[model samples]
Target: MSEQSADPAADLSDDVRLPKEQPTPAFFESKTFRLISLVLYLGGISGLGMVLALYYLIFFDSGMPDIHLKFPVSIGGQPVQKVHEYQ
Candidate 1:
């Protein structure tokens, strides 16, 4: 087996340094961000309000109208007949 080197600096090719932290973006500190955030918040609140209003209209108010439809049905070449007549 080969003998190991005692010097630690011989294993590193160059000196290492920690990376510097970057400053926050200008847009985050601008008024435009605040305006956009407010608009989004209002939009979300209005959407929720509309959903609640629709829920109230559907559940608490006079509900949807009932519909009835009649259609003649036939099988293979047979004439259509009322279902109650057979029973």
Candidate 2:
């Protein structure tokens, strides 16, 4: 057998070793995880967009009637007549 080296640096190189097994796959790698994340993200974005659209439509649009006015108006405990009578 060949004589071993006494130098510390020389022996350290031989002792150093890489891991035999790889780490577990990331969350994004799994199809189920990816799909769930995508669904949640999309759902959140859609909900936010819907809320924004409704806000703009209600606040900015004058053509739409107010919520309180939607109910039938009352005059002395009797419902008011329609704006335009067909007959």
Candidate 3:
């Protein structure tokens, strides 16, 4: 078997190369992103407000009329008065 010689250049050639990292984009660091975020937040709050207002109007508002259905004086062949009454 023949002996091989160790070379420093051969060891350096085996090293890995990595790309340099770049700074963040200008848009992400600009006021435009802040404005957009604010608009979205306000819009969400307004939407929730609208939903709550609609729910209150439908179920809790006093302006709505109260409706009750009363059956006729008699049902089938029996008079409704014959029905059981609480003491």
Candidate 4:
């Protein structure tokens, strides 16, 4: 008789090595896909903000002052030209 065991369970002993199947990831679950999505999302938001800001600057305007203001403003009855203390 051979030295091997006659039992079926003996064939699957600790000495035997097994092959494992690696799990495949879905497209949305992948790291590359998540990074790409984050880039696109941020880019879209910034682009929209820039476009809105441009539109507001080009189209909207603040109303002009109702009363005319005098130029060469004088402070405390002192003429603006005569004030040479800063010089």
Best by TM-score: 4
Question: After superposition on all CA atoms, how large is the RMSD of candidate 4?
Answer: 10.0
What lDDT tens digits, residue by residue, belong to model 1 across residues 1-87?
A: 987679978877865644564555599777999999999999999999999999988877575533211333668966466533321
| Residue pairs with backbone atoms closer than 3 Å in model 4 (clashes) | none
Which wins on lDDT, candidate 1 or candidate 3?
Answer: 1
lDDT of 3 by residue, 13-78 (tens): 555545465555598677999899999999999999999999998887566332212332666876
Off by over 4 Å in 4: 1-20, 64-87
TM-score of 4: 0.48
The better candidate by TM-score, 3 or 4, is 4
Ranking by TM-score: 4, 1, 3, 2
TM-score of 2: 0.38
lDDT of 2 by residue, 1-87 (tens): 988888767866565446865566688798889899999999999999999999998887667655434565779977684443323
Misplaced by over 4 Å in model 3 are 1-25, 60-87
Where's the lowest-lDDT run of ten residues in candidate 1? 63-72
Where in model 1 is the C-alpha error above 4 Å? 1-25, 61-87
In model 3, residue pairs whose N, Cα or C atoms come closer than 3 Å (at least 3 residues apart or on different chains), thus clashing, are none
lDDT of 4 by residue, 1-87 (tens): 768878878778565444454456798999999999999999999999999999889987867653324333577976565333322
